[model samples]
Target chain A: MLVIVMTSIDPLTLVLAIGTPLYLAAAVLYSIRAVRGPTIPDIILAVDCLSYDLAVFLSAIALYYKTPFMTAPPIMLALWVYLLDIYASKYLITREVGV
Target chain B: MIEQVLFWTGSALFIIGGVFDLLGSIGLLRFPSFYVRLHAATIGAIYGAVLPLIGISLIALGSPGIPGNYTIAGASFVTALILLVVAPMGSHVLAHAAHKSKSVSWKPFVDMLEEDEEK
Candidate 1:
């Protein structure tokens, strides 16, 4: 009885737990958009959104786990996304010629 | 005791919101045009990501057993607020960017961005 009670997730933890999978789903959706977007800006924007999302989702998971370590991956995720956006924007400006 | 109830309720909201978000994604995949796809993306972020974040906060806030310092609930709640404010702005930025870039043309309808572009 003690083991069952202690080991079972409290209702709140269960709630926090669901966020990881949902983040996974959203990440996939954003990726799909990034891949399939017809234009340069669309893809860049999708990538941007995905990166921001990974950051926030990572933070949330960190809170759930009560761990400071969960924070690191998202910071890196955001940096990578920002880098991609700058690259994509520069490419769009130079390559896409005209009205 | 109360935490258990609140957690379940928040989770239910999260699931419902997720479904709405999923619907929005499907709309994006299925929609015929860019403008329409914009609608799907915006709605998905709003309904799916933002709403679930709020639900998670509620669950955290309501959960018991944390000492009175309020860090657990407070931080989680703050996270929801940030998402709520930022999500819409992000949507607006993407939609505006997409509209202004003149990358995709809408079909069989009146278009304002085009008018602006023409000027």
Candidate 2:
């Protein structure tokens, strides 16, 4: 997908060219925090940051491809992260997520 | 003319958001403590995710090549909307959970929550 976006010489192409690498770099930094984090919550925070970034990256890809259907991924990604946060918080508070 | 303007606007937003994403990520790496890293992560979630979604939606809405359907634009809008609503709340929950679990210490310079927790 990125290759296709990069081959084109349009404004949207420019946006994707710049955005893709930046998002990847963010993910790298988040991963570092996740792996080296001193506490479980710190690792969870890194993952939360990483997922949000993935949603943004997906939106950029959708724009580059001009595919509306692609937008669905970001929505689902955000929703999933939110669910993760809820369960994580539940676990942190009570050590159980009720299932 | 309008399309060009919208495209450039979207481009600008994407650029700014990308810069923020990079900075936030660097902050995540450099911060001294878990709470500080959380601050950096929150910045990435809100600015990095939301702005680019809006920018992409604008580009999608204005471009002629990619179908430019209203549903597509609407989907991007919804994604951005959901991110805006969810990111902060998720961060807050994580912070609360971290505090409650004693997974990370509250070592801020002021330490207000520390006193409240004791009370």
Candidate 3:
């Protein structure tokens, strides 16, 4: 199966080859920012970006694999990050007041 | 012939989006402030995520080997749209909170928000 899949110069192959490395590089940068971030919001923002990136990567994989089910992960992740943003902000604001 | 067009277009988009994402991440690492970093992150989330998903969808739709490729493409489209909507909103929420809480000193030249709050 792998051999058959690799035999063709498919668009999916091209996308995966070009995109995966770039995403990995971005992830590394995000990790660096998360560790070195001076402020809470900065770290949270990095994490949020990372999650969204993950979703996008998943979407790309779904396309490459031609699996509709794979798309669901990206959708769930995108929505999840939004909620994280809200709650994180709420926590940041409230934590200051001793609440 | 149509598939060839789509395949080439998708490949181009994928490469372009990858470049943007890498640039955004570099900016995130190099930027001076939290707000600037937020800007970079927005670029990553928006251009980085959306464009590539679009490319992937196009590829899926064009590739004959994948079964139910249209369904996969539709899913990618929906995911990309959702990312487009949500990413900026998330950035806004984070930036607003950061500003309000004084988590990071922005020190913008205009200071409109500060003036408005004062008034």
Candidate 4:
């Protein structure tokens, strides 16, 4: 699989070869912040950044594999992460998760 | 001609997004406070995520060889739009909650929100 992807001269393939590693490095950095954050908001912020980046990654992978099914997950992931932000904020303000 | 244009444009966007992603992540890690890191988060959310999603959609549309390319393009485009609407709102809400709750310690030169609330 690696050899096949590397051999392709497609523009998409070239972009993926360069872009994927950058995204991976970013993900690692975000994870570090998330793990060692001093406050709740810091953790949430790091997580929000990570999730959004992941959505992009997922879409790129879907394109690479030529799979339509994988495209749906990024949207769902983005929606769910937004819900997380809302819920976390609500909890912080009200001191309760429920409405 | 159009396909080549689309492909190259998407490739450029992808590279730009990747660079922004790395920069934002570095800022997120290096920034001293939670409030300061929000700027980095915004960069990561909008440029890092949205741009690449748009690029992916364009690549899908341009690449005829991909199976169900139209579906891939449509879904990625929709995802990018949704993230555009959702990310800032989420960040704002989180920042507001953090401020109100006094969860993070930071030194502000002029805290108008605190001053206003005290009055």
Candidate 5:
């Protein structure tokens, strides 16, 4: 007879287990706001939150998989989202992309 | 001992970040206006995202089981720092744009910017 007993869980695993679901829930709520928001700023705000959250999630996933190369994407995503904010605001204010 | 300390501390931070994320998202959904929702987005950005990235960095540093733990830690830490700086700037720019464009529907009692503009 073979018996497998699970005694202890890895701390990182435990943290990931508890944290990921919460992030997912937050993402879903933000998505709802993005869809239903009446104004463009409201939608942009929701997307901003979503992208930041996604960066966190991606980093955590990279840690989980022990893939160091994967960490690069989160930083890129964050930078690009910042660009999105700047470009969108520029367009909103000037009503044109080029000044 | 150090590994254990890092692991536990990181875990605690990770959990707190998760709670903040949930709260911020709820606030985003329930807030009455776009301007008000900016507060919620700030919460989500600083508390929910940056904190967890820092926590992930700590966890990566502590976990010797991860193959390239140093790389993961460094990357996450840099990402957190970038987010800390970028998030608020983005929020400020967006709010300014929204206000200038008069995209906000709700009127505040103060209207300091409008008053200044008029003067």
Candidate 6:
């Protein structure tokens, strides 16, 4: 009973079901700016922060959609490499123009 | 019943927050410069992601389960708490890094760090 039980539609599912697409759109907007950004660190930060949000968003999806498999990788991406990329990119930029 | 209500309310807030986050991301893409995009990214995470995480936790408390309830509730709670603490701090760090690196050239509004930079 415990393992196989599937809960009925919780209202929260509506949150992720709607939220993910909207957030992705917003992220795309931010990324567009990042793409055109005057400096390197700016793009890096946008990508980093968006990826972090995406991970959290994915976790909610996994819960509502009942798909843990879809959630785990994004979670890992946000928690792990996202920040590193920002840091590494910053270091590179600092070296590039001494900014 | 009360738990269910709270769960649903939290869910709405969470979803509302996520929508903001999405908008923030969209704003990031639409904005002309890095600094402006940063505003979108920060508000997106703060308004969008954090709120939803809290809502998810509230909903989890109402779910019936043996271990799944505990597992989901505990992990989600920790994740929410960590994000609440970390997200803003990360934003601050990123902003500082960008400023130091001069990654963003212009801003449409005044900055607190601008005063800090003068000192």
For all candidates listed, what's the TM-score of chain B alone? Answer: 0.74, 0.89, 0.94, 0.96, 0.97, 0.76
For model 5 chain A, where is the 10-residue window of minimal lDDT?
A: A1-10
CAPRI band for model 2: medium
**Candidate 4 Cα errors over 4 Å, as ranges:** A1-9
TM-score of chain B of 3: 0.94
Which of candidates 1 and 5 reaches a greater TM-score? 5
Which is the better candidate, 1 or 3, if ranked by lDDT?
A: 3
Candidate 2 chain B worst ten-residue window by lDDT: B64-73
Q: Which candidate is the best by DockQ?
A: 3
lDDT of each: 0.59, 0.80, 0.81, 0.90, 0.90, 0.63
Query: Docking quality tier of candidate 6?
Result: acceptable
Which digits, one per residue and each the tens of the lDDT, describe model 4 over residues B34-103? 8889999999999999998898888888887777889999999999999999999999999999999888
lDDT per residue for candidate 1 within A1-99, as digits (tens), equals 445545666655665566556667767887898799877656665665565555556546655665434444544453344454444444444555332
Q: How many residue pairs clash in each candidate?
A: 0, 0, 0, 0, 0, 13
lDDT of 5 by residue, B23-104 (tens): 9999999999988899999999999999999998888878877678899999999999999999999999999999898877
Model 4: how far residue B8 lies from native, Å: 0.8
How do the residues B51-82 of candidate 2 rate in per-residue lDDT, one tens digit apiece?
A: 87787777776776665446666787798888
**What does TM-score give for chain A of every model?**
0.64, 0.81, 0.79, 0.84, 0.86, 0.63
Reference A-B contact fraction recovered by candidate 4: 0.93
Show pairs that collide, candidate 4.
Answer: none
TM-score of chain A of 3: 0.79
Among all windows of 10 consecutive residues in model 4 chain B, the one with the lowest summed lDDT is: B59-68
Evaluated at residue B112, the lDDT of candidate 1 is: 70
Q: Give TM-scores for every candidate, taking all chains together and pairing residue i with residue i.
A: 0.68, 0.89, 0.90, 0.93, 0.94, 0.73
The CAPRI-style docking tier of model 5 reads: medium
